[model samples]
Target: MAKADGLDLIAVGRSCVDLYGEQTGGRLEDMLSFAKYIGGSPTNTAVGASRLGLDAGLLTRVGEDHFGRFIREQLAREGVDTRGVVADPARLTALAFLGIRDPDTFPLVFYRENCADMALEAGDIDPAFVASARAVLINGTHLSQPGVFAASMEACRLARAAGGKVVFDIDYRPVLWGLAGKDAGENRFVADAAVTARLQQVLPLCDLIVGTEEEVHILGGSTDTIDALRAIRERTPALLVCKRGAQGCSAFADAIPDSLDQGVVGRGFAVEVFNVLGAGDAFMAGFLRGWLRGAPLAECCEWANACGAIVVSRHGCSPAMPTWEELQAFLRDEARPFRLREDAALEHLHWATTRATGYPSLTVLAMDHRSQFEALCERTGAAPERIAGFKSLALRAVDRVAAGDPGFGVLLDGRFGMRALEAAAAYPYWIGRPIELPGSRPLEFESSADVATELATWPANHVVKCLALYHPDDPQELRERQERQLLRLQDAARKTRHELLVEIIASRGGEVAEDTAARAIERLYALGIRPDWWKLEPDDRAGAWRGIEDAIVRNDPHCRGVVLLGLSAPQDELIASFAAAAQAPIVKGFAVGRTIFADAAEQWFAGTIDDEAAIDDLARRFAILVEAWRDAKQRAQTQAIRETA
Candidate 1:
């Protein structure tokens, strides 16, 4: 049985792989290359809806082939449920080649003859899965096939019987309809009495129906556009949305108006057009965003328009589809949430801070800074010899924490943290090494010139931790230098298959900006650099982490979350910061340096306390922080469940 509230939408029908031409202002023959992305109306809508943080699912058939595997994987990665996505071993998945003719037009060619999706059988439909969804979505093409037609009918029946709404996307693809003449101009739709009669059979079943003028004409069986809408309205008062490109779309839930091709429609957020394909699917997703959230009619249309505008300005449909946070963020900015959900970067920074999964609860013992250790030794006057004992104390703590097979990691440098690294190597624990050197703006590094070569030899769990003092307020030269350094590290990790942990301590007092960490993260992604993990300082609110998390997820969906860094603050203060950061799902655990082991180092270096006692004291503080992290993770998850409920 599907979990209650598990699947909000189940979209059934054709899903294909889209090969978009890379070369612009060209014909199909003129294009040099093509970009691959998930395509097809139903698939695009499901992916788009999922990007907006909806609990969506797909019900379709694909060939038991590479393309089919890719479709399922992409959907699952986007958080779409795919249990209903069946693979037929006999046929091939559908494929579409989209060519860039000009800024306004994209020439699309369908290779769907005997495709897997078109071969859907009645036995393919799962009654329980349909019953579980809040809405059941089907495309008009599904009705063109006898076997799939029965399947679509069963889905509609199950959804209605289960008290769920049925949504009809009048996605007219005339080639699928066997229309072979100019009567099928550009393969949009052909106004036919038989097609109109066929669509009318399901008109009464839909709670909401979306289509272009051509699609409405095909569905309503009338030559005149308004007449067709009026015919559908007379049969059923299903909410109708007329998609008019560039001018925006209209909504009618009641009787058709006498107005000539216009009404008091929701205004559209207009932007320069790139490719007009998939605009309809994007509009539907946007409308659903408002309708499902129970927004007013005007606002629903506004959201739809806003979504379409953002998508048009961007590239592919589903990849360009904005998240709820992204859309909300663009809305706030366009007057818009330009970051589209980079706020998720914070959640990525928060609860899920850990990208590598060896540890259940990470109580990191951080004592990796060389300068700090050297300074502590200089100040205490007991001995520089005690620094090795400091690593020893941290190692003891690691051993203690790791007793139950629950893993832990330590941040150590090859300079001062050599003994700690040597000791940690023996155990099955997370090991992090600093790849970038400590300095001011325009950071300096040794192996960064050949980071990829150096990193290729490291252990898989070896997370290269680099600390850079970067903020948007920095000089342009400084920013460029930092970006270059980060990309260097990124290239290394990508080649080595080792984990990367970036610690950006934005220089404060110079800039009193909010979301410094997030902005810094955005800068890295803007440079096409994505780290496996981010090490961040605590924020006052969960919202502060959103940008960082969003950028991480956007740049690399497989990103390990961000961890909290103590920055050597007092233990009491570090505990409080952990409490704030723990509430975020993006935060996996805390990587504390000074606040955790500083006190022990000072006493041990001063000869005021023995090494054994210092280790014990460090162990106690470490234990306290570990318990705090566990407690915080639990509380955050509980709140998450409650919010979901």
Candidate 2:
């Protein structure tokens, strides 16, 4: 089958949220915490295909709620088209609770009573939309219910009418078919003739069929693998792929062979299994990646086997699937480790490549001043309680400037800016909250020493901004303590899935070297603390900026570019610094606070100016800096184009 102009694959079936137990080798009843991720057979396949550089789309329904929005947003982030994902207002999104009991045992519970995905009716499938994709994958679970069965059949009809292949993943779940008890979700197979009849109705419409040995048994009506393959072959002329857990997989395009080894077999990798929940989905995704391009069946099975092997050694399903680059690296590395989770390079590659968003340029107003704000209240005789109101006014100024642009951000503190932060949550602006205590030499958190506990209360969108009064030349004891604290904070950020921005001030007190900022960043990399962003003071020398860029690229190429910080410098000086650092592509944008707000804040606190006046003055100053940065960025782009020419 030739590829279409639109999506390469459209997976029409179950899409739900999966909450995996954090405590490994434990029962679901004893688990204390869980991590949420997108799940379901077809959904996982779509995500896996998208990660492998396929233009995949999902045809499913989710409830009109938080989880629904999350599913859509995550698919969009993964580069999967969500145009066919419907939000059913009447039903709640489906959820699956999974636990890791042992290497071979995984306990699962499906919370899918009248779920939105299952409620998908035939009317939901658009004929034109189905034909736009080169292939439509329908899972067996979606064919169990009448409503979804009609929808799946409609998609299969539309796909075939447009000369598109219909791929059927025999994702057999006995509980989903009412053949097993509700709590028997972990049961992979049950001998049921009714379920086979239902699945057979869609077999002739399929061009490709994938299933495990047990899944084939359920579909082909026999416990014997060869008998199941031959029985299913008689029902459909599609190619059959039998997944044999660790031994690998075999694909049969013609007559069923006498033995399982008589087909085109692909060898599987030798890796320790963690949870075998999503391996089949990963295998199907990888197989399609090759098959859609008209690759040989042997090669397709190889890709499928590798994907399954990688996923089986990881934790969750969709999140654990390998990216194109990661898969290539794994395939090329002869010395690849047996434990995929312990491979730091592969883990970092996955984490960096799968980030939700990327900010090309950010113009932020940093007003996370705690000690400075308190001191202003002290000097002006204003009540300390009024600080919150002042922060609200400042946020208004930022809102006015960020009316149309999404690149604008704010660095506010929870202590005095809680009201502003709450307001910012309603918008799509980049908002960061400070964690470090003001002017702390050895780096102390504002709230509890347990940074993760403090971060647990924060919104996921809020970036964790921590300012360290760290100098590369500090005493060994002080530097080590600060480094330890920063490491702890970084760990917490990773655990909480919050983006981290580490603001470094290398010239805290003594004379600074030209390469101090670079060395400071290098030191952090050596300690394995890679923040998503670095907030650094702009350097006057081009060479200094180059050194910093080299350090970042050499250490963590996926690190988000640096954002220049203003240390209360004059507006003109700050503008000049922007021009000086403009040539460095590593610098994304600026986050200046005191340079824009200090004077107006002082005037407002002293009662020399009213709220509007203070807000207007701060807004005007902020706009000036934003314009300066943009002008410099444009100039740099023009220079780059000229050099390339």
Candidate 3:
């Protein structure tokens, strides 16, 4: 029934809104903030492709609710064609909620039943739509859902029949199919059986299968990569790409004589990460971008790694994505092939260098003493003349990095408060530890100057950060205390920035808050600042459940609305809790974070402040976790109505 245009790609299956937050260093109950972002594997990949200048369209369903509208708007903004993204009057869009306490390790969560995306039928995907694309990228998660499994396989078949390629990413959410309810053992077994059957049917027909090593093992029913490839090759003979995360990625050509022989594997470039949310999608985007540009399979792997490296260095999914020009430039400068090895070997350094080239080297020049700083310089092969005291040295390093690197973060020690050090802490270029304004008495009375003179010397545009008071190696209770302390420090830093701005205003009869300064600066350059005018928070602490919702709309076009996070006691109570919050007319989106994470995964743990890497990773995961929860909540509500009727 559907007609297809000359679309380059049509992404079929599920799409949902992702609601998440960083609670690891602290519990949700302890925090006053959360972030809402868009998520859904198929949606993510489609957007990734679009950001790289591909003509990609999303063929999916979302509810006729605010969440649905947000999803549509997001896709349109990302340059994804949503003309085929159907809206379901009967069901709500799927929602996913994620929570992370520690970002370095994995954060866990799940999907809900009967969401709008799962209700997609064969008729929803028009035959012309399948005919229009060069390829159709499908998510394995859809196969676990009801009508979607059949609809997806049929779409794949139709696409192939119409001479289009099929790309399958085995985004295996194991727990999604695992047993968990009171009768979870039996329910999970049955669900696993149904999913396994669906997978067996779809995989063989795929032109390309992308998955992680763990996913390949699970799908192949074996631990061995080669064995798994041989098994899949026997059926579809499709190109197999096994993504190895930080290790990089590998691929198998269908034309290779020995199907059993291991295919080419490439190591990923090393990158310090701010988040790993959409790294996989970024990889797929790069690989496809390169493949579409006529690069060989090996080069495709290189491109994929480079894209992933760039992604991890940044934040969020679509917003953090790199364009085609960025990827091409990175590849031209950094692409190298080498045999993988352990970290201590020369082969390792060679690999690291190649991969590192893709990322401009961001060195964190830290020192407890001048000698330690000098030693680091020696190790990094920096000339002695370049190594000044802590501040100059850090500035030189930042200049070197910024000249070649897109942007990098820095942490400067507070013990050495050089004049340059004060300057570096401004503009988010460096994070200063154990430092306060010149006259702060709590910091051991370091400087005594005319208070006004000192105020004038401070960087007006700098984002002042207080040193975290928590010990990095403390135990549980101690860690919690440290976390609380750091939060207080964050609060203090915010206050200091505000007070200083207020002081500046008193002197000049104007406002000087950092946010105000940022906006004023952006207006000068005709550049747009991110939407920081509003925040999302819980309406009440009366319950344990929370609802993640759509963005709050403000009457003023210049300001963003406050995000609402609703909490209630437990299950059978979240909807009611959300209903209470909805009584207030301005709430944009509703979500249940801890409730969903606990239900989807295991017990929820808060993150520790000591682990910055983990904090970053966990923050991103929380976003994904929130997405799963919102999706599940809508589906559960829709299913409840279906059953009652």
The best candidate in terms of TM-score? 2
* Ranking of all predicted structures according to lDDT, beginning with the best and ending with the worst: 2, 1, 3
- The number of residue pairs in model 3 that clash at the backbone is 54
Instruction: Please list the C-alpha lDDT of all candidates, in the order they appear.
Output: 0.75, 0.90, 0.53
Question: Model 3 lDDT vs. the true structure?
Answer: 0.53
User: What is the lDDT for 425 in model 3?
Assistant: 43
User: CA lDDT of 207 in candidate 1?
Assistant: 94
How far residue 598's Cα lies from its native spot in candidate 1, in Å, is 25
| Structural similarity to truth (TM-score) of each candidate | 0.62, 0.96, 0.51
Q: Give the per-residue lDDT digits (tens) of candidate 2, residues 1-645.
A: 335468899999999999999789878889988888999999999999999988999999999999999899889989889999999999999999998989978989999999999999899988888889999999999999999999999999999999899999999999999888988899999999999899999999999999999999999999999999999999999999999999899899999989999999985788889989999999999999999988888989989999998999888899888888888877887777888777777777777877876888899999888898899899999999988888888888988998956688888999999999998877778898899988998889998858998997788889999999898888999999999999999888877778899999887845677889899999999999899999998777888889999999999899988999999999999999997688889899999999999999889988899999999998999999999999998998898899999
Q: What lDDT tens digits, residue by residue, belong to model 1 across residues 124-194?
A: 98888888888889989899878888888889999999988899998887767777542222468666777
Tens digit per residue, CA lDDT, model 3, 279-380: 788888777776655678888888788778776654345544666655665556533322212112222122222210121111222221334444545655
Q: Report how far residue 337 has shifted in candidate 2, in Å.
A: 2.7
By TM-score rank, best first, the candidates go 2, 1, 3
Model 2 residue 139 distance off true place after TM-score fit, in angstroms: 0.4
Compute the lDDT for candidate 1: 0.75
